[model samples]
Target: MPFVQEALDGIEFARGDPNSTWGSVRAAMGHPEPFTLKYVAIGNEDCWKPHYRENYLKFYAAIRKAYPDIKMISNCDGSNAQLDHPADMYDFHIYQNANTVFSMANTFDRTSRVGPKAFVSEYAVTGDDAGRGSLLAALAEAAFLIGLEKNSDIVEMASYAPLFVNTNDRRWNPDAIVFDSSQAYGTPSYWMQHFFSDSNGATLLKSTLQANSSNSLEASAILFQNPMDKGNYMRIKVVNFGSSPVDLKIVIDGFDRKLLDSSGSKTVLSSTNVKDENSFANPEKVVAQVSPVKSLVEKTGTNMDLVLLPHSLTCFDVLMKSDITQITADDDSHVSSM
Candidate 1:
């Protein structure tokens, strides 16, 4: 394979182009080291079109023959109707209101587990409910992401859309990061991603909540290593979608009280108003505010009760101080003197 450094060279990648681009990888890199190319998607949102399958077959045949290890994604969705061609995965794009997207976290729960895995290439909260990536939008999207994290087995990958918007040029609104002139600011949608940036290969936990407001809440727990010290810690993330504050009892089914940190910091994304957006005059109007949770005196040993604000996203990063019980799942008696 040859490395393609330009569009003309890439154009040769078509199925039968005389100067095919697939054969340039070796020459471009000056070596035969395999490129870590695992996934490639066809045209987006072109499903159900007559020419889609036709165009897809050409690339599919050429790529499959040239690189048999590469996994191909079809533009058509076989989640509902089976496509005539073979594909390793399907592209599923979605755009809806904040409230609707909140419920969309469970979108793939009913999909048949036997078919191609789902690749949510594009999704975001738009329309009147989302004014240039407002807090309401981020809260809903955070919940939806939690659902994706829970069902990651079938959901191969997912991503947010409108990643950038140039204030100088009026084009797409509700972007994750907005920039213009000499300054750049991240929307709530952008800050919300920080909470999940380290979950890529981290170990996910089975954390459960028992409260009357549980239905309006979405959460996922994971044990990720700290980059500075490489120490493992339990990070619990939650998104509250209701109007009233929730008194959540943070219960870990597999963690011991002795290993828990003396106290942790809570990062929350909320504002005086749900529809608040960042402006040049007030860039920090809507951002993830970090505050120490050292005053957590309301708990029953390993069971700690934290109050969750309504329409907000929160994460508690508790450090692992020392070795504790290695039991898999049990509510250990809280040792106050840890």
Candidate 2:
């Protein structure tokens, strides 16, 4: 208990005012500004251990009293069940096979909206399917992330585990970035993160995949503004986990009849083979390819047919002519805009 208190005190001092006790020490070390530390976890993956709840309560009470504004995270997963203890948020971790991880995109679909939000602090596609970071693993993780985007209300945060690994001594396999003393390169999983870079504050648009028989398709749409050009764009990200190609028809409802311009781009993150990986010798083997979308023009009510590649993650970025600040759903059926 003493040790935990001391640790908490130090953390508080680090983020405290420069006039405070430990903040003075930090200032004397040449830095005066406090670090932005808002979230803290009681313990990592220790909810099932003996006496974890007892010790956790003590720590929680102390922290709650000292720093009430800081969001405390509990290790217990409250996704499927309500937590007995109090927490601002709960930690959720998953390390599973490709198929399972892909299907788990809807893992939080049925979670209660009244409880603490979930912090998926750790997640990855592991085992033989994710051998040293393969395209297959990246595709599955992308699909899962699309699910998270659809359920972002309940999921406060999510991240890929084992971010960087040294090539010389790889204690953990399938890391996102691989590094050596001289050079560095990103795996397919690392490049996959680029697909969601614009999703932080973007507005999620309603999207649906009307397939007859295939259950291997997952997709989501978002409306985001380009920081550079200051133009609004609609990005439709889709992941096809099966081997068969899909001819998907994208219909944008509640959109202007001639709003879409011909100047649009399509970005795809895929490779020739599913299990293909990137090494120092061939870093660009499995990377995202950007191309112009020639088919999209001043279409009528935004009706377009898209061919999704098998086992690939594709993003169709269509530039919007006007800024869409708000959208209301139709009464009869929920309409999705591409």
Query: Each candidate's lDDT (Cα)?
Result: 0.75, 0.83
Q: Under the 3 Å rule for N, CA and C atoms, how many clashes does model 2 have?
A: 0
- For candidate 2, write residues 143-192 as lDDT tens digits: 88888887787787888999999999999879999999999999999999
Give the alpha carbon lDDT tens digit for every residue of 1-338 in model 1: 13213322343333223333553554454533434457767667776777777777777777677557668898887656666788999898878998899998887667776878888888889999888879999999999988777667677777889798898885776889888879999988899988887666655666678766987899887666777767666678999988889998866676667667667778999987889988777888889999887645225545768788878999988776753234353332121110
- For model 1 the local lDDT of residue 61 reads 74
TM-score against native, each model: 0.83, 0.93
Candidate 2 collision pairs: none
**Lowest-scoring 10 consecutive residues by lDDT in candidate 2?**
329-338
